[model samples]
Target: MGFLTDTTHMHIFTWVVGIVLFLVAASMANGTKGKKITHMILRLFYVLIIITGAALFFKHMTIDSMLYGIKFVLGILTIGFMEMVLVRGNKGKNTGLMWILFIIALLATMFIGFKLPMGFNFFA
Candidate 1:
């Protein structure tokens, strides 16, 4: 079942890679040099964060086996939100709230890799 184990890892990896690329490409398409660089760096960090987090998740996670899935969805949502609201128009019109939410989501996402108390699965 080595391939089966690899499937899950590959699934997560591909999804993360795809979303980051989509975000970076979208940012580049918008023609903002600063945003492009920032987005690219953030996207790279997003991949690294997920990769390292995956290792931690395998070692300590319990309760919600779906935490990774939830994080995946949130990653997509966060990228979409950034594209639609922050990067959509002026690219500089106050996005403090969006940035705050993005950072919060990223932090929360990182935390999901660790174990938590019983019967506290957010998805449940």
Candidate 2:
């Protein structure tokens, strides 16, 4: 449980993992032939993402701040919504509301993730 010493490695890994999760989840939503398999993989991928995130947070526990706390809560909501959609088993319902929330959360995550100047620097 060490901080990623090489920022590049962390960035690359995160990108790869995120894209894979997105692809799998999207494919499942699109009614892929192996929808069940894709769903399972997506679930596992999400679990890993959360676990790794928690580990990183623990590593930097002293960095606790309102921004990080908010992000954590958002992440939890994202995962909860994802689970709900997966279990609902109705394409139309899943695509309508949950997917929209998922996309919004994803975009928000990206925005905060890069520390983009979105009118504030919460990490500061």
Candidate 3:
């Protein structure tokens, strides 16, 4: 548990890879095998992101429980919007709203994450 609690590097890496995979999968043709494979890998990253994020959240939760709680919810919403966008796109449905929501949530999550005491203090 010390390794997980020591730093935010693992959590950051998972989300960055997840975002890259999401873009790659989203840009590919929906019905293609490549897209499906990428999507599966992206889903694995999603799980990794949640696990690492939860570990960090629990580790530093005592500092400011309410803020961390908000960050956790925003992180979940960001992931949800990402999945919705990909699924709706694959189904040939409109995904404009989901994309908008995804961007907003992602930006908000990143901002709050940086502001937190544990991570890099770029905001400070």
In order, the Cα lDDT scores of the candidates are: 0.53, 0.57, 0.92
Runs of candidate 1 with Cα error greater than 4 angstroms are 1-64, 84-91, 114-124
What's the C-alpha lDDT at position 107 in model 3? 96
TM-score, per-candidate, Cα-based = 0.40, 0.66, 0.96
Q: Which tens-of-lDDT digit does each residue in 6-115 have in candidate 3?
A: 98988999999999999999899889999999999999999999999999988789854587989999999999999999999999999999999999999999999888
lDDT of 1 by residue, 1-124 (tens): 3432333455345446645654555445456676567566656655654554454445445565677567656655655555554454445466567666766765665455332332135553
Candidate with the larger TM-score of 2 and 3: 3
For residues 60-87, could you state the per-residue lDDT of candidate 2 as single tens digits?
A: 4355455555555666676766666666
Assess candidate 2 and give its TM-score to the true structure: 0.66
Q: By lDDT, is 1 or 2 better?
A: 2
- Alpha-carbon RMSD of each model: 8.4, 4.7, 1.1
Clashes per model (N, Cα, C within 3 A): 0, 0, 0
List the candidate numbers ranked by lDDT, top first: 3, 2, 1
What candidate 2 gets wrong by more than 4 Å, as runs, is 3-19, 28-33, 89-94, 116-124
